[model samples]
Target chain A: MLDNLQLLFVWAPVMNVQMILDGVFVGAVFALSAYGLALVWGVMNVKNLAQGDFVIMGGYIAYALFHPLHGMGLPTWVIIPILIVVAMAMMFVFGHIVYQLIIKRVIDQDMFTSLLATFGLSLLMQQVINLIFGPEVQIIDSELPILTAFDSFVTIPTVKIVSLVMAMALAVVVVIFMKTSRTGQAIRATAQDPRAARVLGIDTDRVYAFTFSLNAAICGAAGVLVSMIWVIQPFYGIVYSVRSFCDGGGAGQFAGGDRDGVRPRSY
Target chain B: MKFKSLKTMVVSAAVVASVSMAGSAMAKVEGDTITLGSSISLTGKYATNGLHTTRGYDYAIKVINEAGGVKVGGKTYKLAVKYYDDESTPARGAQLAERLIQQDGVEFMLGPYSSGMTKAIAPVSEKFGVPMVEAEGASRSLFTQGYKYLFAVLSTSEQYLSTTIELAAQTTDNPSEIKVAMAFENDPFSLDVREGVVDAAKKYGMKIVIDDKLPADLSDMSATLTKVKALRPDVLIVSGHSKGAATAARQLEEMKVSVPIIGMTHCEAAKIQEKFPKAAQGIMCATQWVEGIPKRDSMFGSASDWNEGFKAEYPSYSSVPYQSAQASAAVLVWKEAFEAANSFDKDAVRDAISAIEMETFYGDIKFSAAGNNIAKPMFMRQIDANGNYNLVVTADDMQFPRKAGY
Candidate 1:
């Protein structure tokens, strides 16, 4: 019986299944953070240096809603959606302000200015978060039990499961909105060729504003997903930003003699 | 007329040279004030540890100075400390060590807290012929380097963990056969501790039920604890820092896992109890300093008195990190050696430091033949039911198990 049990453990097919699921759970968060970076690159042809900071900001909002606001009868599950909406709205406003005040001036300049400007914005945002939250790490939780099977061969944290589902749903919504929305189409056209897009009925200035806002919204969604599994801190933004840059997945060139707004690596 | 004026000029030059030479000697003591250099990490990820250690040095210096420093060779001299922050990087640590020896001219050196940084700086000690009193680093290879200059104050990680395991074996119903689980960070100190535990466990015919590396930035340990619970080991040995230990304990408590956590050097900090008040209780860790050790052998007044003094001085600082206490003891060593040598000669002070065997605030300390500091005395401390750590076993205690981990 002992020999049989040992053999059974060694030959367990369920072990492979568990490892794959664990990898998937870990990969989903990575994909979600990347998607946000991709979206902004896809829309504006301007890589937001502060993308990571926006993610961290979204996390803080989620944490505040889940823990502190939960005392006022708000359910934990519902807090994530509210956090997403608030993060999106705030980021949208921030994007508009940043573009009109800073980005518009350097839209025609070399990539160095936009890169440096965005990086400076990122650092400033990180410091601001640090001042407000202090340096200690914080997390969002619904106090759920961990899910496991096969005598601990397969382990799944409930937070990761929920985050995976939420991230996928958000990604789908963003994709659909870009395809069907009137403003998204004009932004796409403007991303392709600002001069040609201007000759068409598209307002290039308005497209830039819309594109920046869309990127912020996507970032806000990613932040909501991140807070579910990982502890968030102000310093975390730089790491996420570097990872996004390294992956180079979102923006590129299109056939219409225009820059594809989704070209993540090019800009 | 020309001869007279030339003689006068030569006499004036002679007088000026003699006066300047006298001034230089007066400013620097030959052997009285022992000059020791430290290449410690004072600002970086390890800064929090270094900041508290600086206090320990100050406290030790204050007491020694108040007592008129070390008395040796019929003259007394104060201890002089020269320190440079390495920023917790190995390259920086080596550079600082080189500077301390070549530029500052420290007779003897004190090692840093982390093993990797200490190893990086180890060559400087050999090159300069300045003996190093290693207090915090526990890498056996450091002491085993065969260099006459390197002397370790604290016991190696393996020795401590092995002793703890021996103690646990005594408590178990089956002395010869036991199931053990090991969890530690993938760092040098913890890795050494893990290796020692595994070796001892195997030697004692104990089965290792589980062994895994906890991620460095791991905030949640519930998933890991569940694995431990399933393993159902008779003992769970956790090798990590305060945060990691507390998190492990917290998760074990939440999961209703009942195995006792045998901790590494990381859990010795007072902040562990404050961080995980309930979970920290009953966990055991080994250290060179303990607040509950009997006052006669310890250097810092009484253990409790020293602890109280630290609390009063820096209320925000966590309970004493053992490395800080080691730094305190190092200052006393420097004072004693300087007094013994009575000259600032590096060779003389190095010899004096090697000869020192005294009862300091930490306990009885002396350097071994290899120049590794033998001053560090071990104590087995346990966080009690009230979440307070008390010295359960001292080196002097007859009941204290000495062969590692009991």
Candidate 2:
């Protein structure tokens, strides 16, 4: 134990500014995905256990587009953002279909029911993704250059900085959409009081579907960013899921009583 | 209604007949064939290596049969394999091993790919009293269990990285001044590799700067790389299968953390040189077989000959992975034992295998009391300048270590 402490203290000076910078950049990606999870949980009143699988699926979509285009004469700067938008759009449609076929049934049920349902969905999606992509780990091959500082003690890839900017920009767009748009208002109203919103002639079911799709779009965007900056595989979905769940809880508390005045359950 | 019922009866009879025919085809030994059973990971996480292992077995069996089969008691018997997809799950591996022994009546068995799967299947082989020669599973803990029925042809995981230390000592005049940093995946195989490196480093009087556990998923290693950059260890060693190796290579390049000597396991098996040649160059790795070995035998001939035949048959097979070579050697060991025993009896074959000692194109085969290969020495290879592995160190040749650079 003494030796352990001594070692830790000796290594303490080495754990410097660069480590924190890396953690913050990685954590930003997690926050983006978690915001999506929180959006769905808050509006639809359903927990999506397959949230990470959706993210991976989106990553594969971006990879499918980027890998082929990478061999072409197209530049990464031209292909990456375009493919990300395409992936988000594709996931939006996928999420709508998923909600119509499976999640809609459990949306109004107890949290346990939705949990079990989405858990099964998560397993099915993981296997399907594995079959489609084969089990090899893949990266987007963004070919973005690395940036070094402090005589190379601190290293940051340009792709990571791009991903952080994209994540923050998306989060801001989501917040603005929720505060302004008619559909977003319907979603917030339903989350505030579904029975009252139904009595007010709002199509609560459509609102739920739209909110779920929007959440999936957000996840898809985050996944595209993740594919650009880090490595992804079929089985690595659960780690992202756990990270997002933690982020969702923290974000829920921080934003509590500001907009909807509803306390996020202690998930 | 009566005519429909008759049709249904005829269909049912045809189905039963087909089922029985399929079962009989698998069950029959055909008077001139010896069938060995295995539960390989054909469809799961270990599928890539599992494919290599199975193909090795197939190629070896084909070669043996073409060479007039195994002669036992003046009768030649062709070799056949009966394998099931274990799905890379231990429980499934054990279940299939039992099925192979009891239901299929296989007299001999071959082990699975990973050490975990082998550990699960070893007890079943012991209980059924069938001798198994395994090539892929290398976890040292699997040997210490004292199971007599199980044997592994590959060197134990503990020996995987000892040669890196040895290579370091040969390259440097002051070996004690060399500092090593190791990051190993916290799995059975990698943990064993860590143990080997630590022991070997101590023996060579080297200093260990950082020893960290890579998480199971191997998703992130930035923090570890950051520390590595600061400490600037003389050598950086990683042992986390293909994914871990890829992570190390990619992250090392991204972080610009260059060590003088970089050694890793599974650089060839994972095809890292082909995938990321820029990052892969100058990285030395431990392997079970190299192509230019002088060892030869009647069944497989020399290493180059075996590789040529394998590539001719499998045109897309770029490099001869160690998994396939060791797996083919496992079959050769079985053939040698069967021929020496001069009988098909299980007890006689087991005895012959226990007392057997020989060298093949893959390597030497001599099992210790713990059923691990002791005769074969692991060699070191470096990814050369042209994105191909060059044999840097063998039993006969030891060269200067290349420094890691872009």
Maximum-DockQ candidate:
2
TM-score of chain B of each: 0.81, 0.89
**Candidate 2 lDDT, tens digit per residue, B205-270?**
999988989876677887778767777787788988767877787787778777767889888666
What clash pairs does model 2 have? none
Candidate 1: which stretches are off by over 4 Å?
A1-25, A39-263, B1-37, B42-48, B51-55, B58-85, B100-108, B173-176, B214-230, B242-265, B268-272, B277-282, B295-299, B375-377, B390-406
lDDT of 1 at A221: 68
- Report per-candidate DockQ: 0.11, 0.31
Docking class of 2: acceptable
True contacts kept of each: 0.02, 0.36
Once superposed on the true structure, which residue ranges of model 2 sit more than 4 Å away at CA?
A: A1-15, A108-113, A252-264, B1-35, B42-45, B58-87, B99-107, B312-317, B335-345, B394-405
Q: What TM value does model 2 have?
A: 0.87
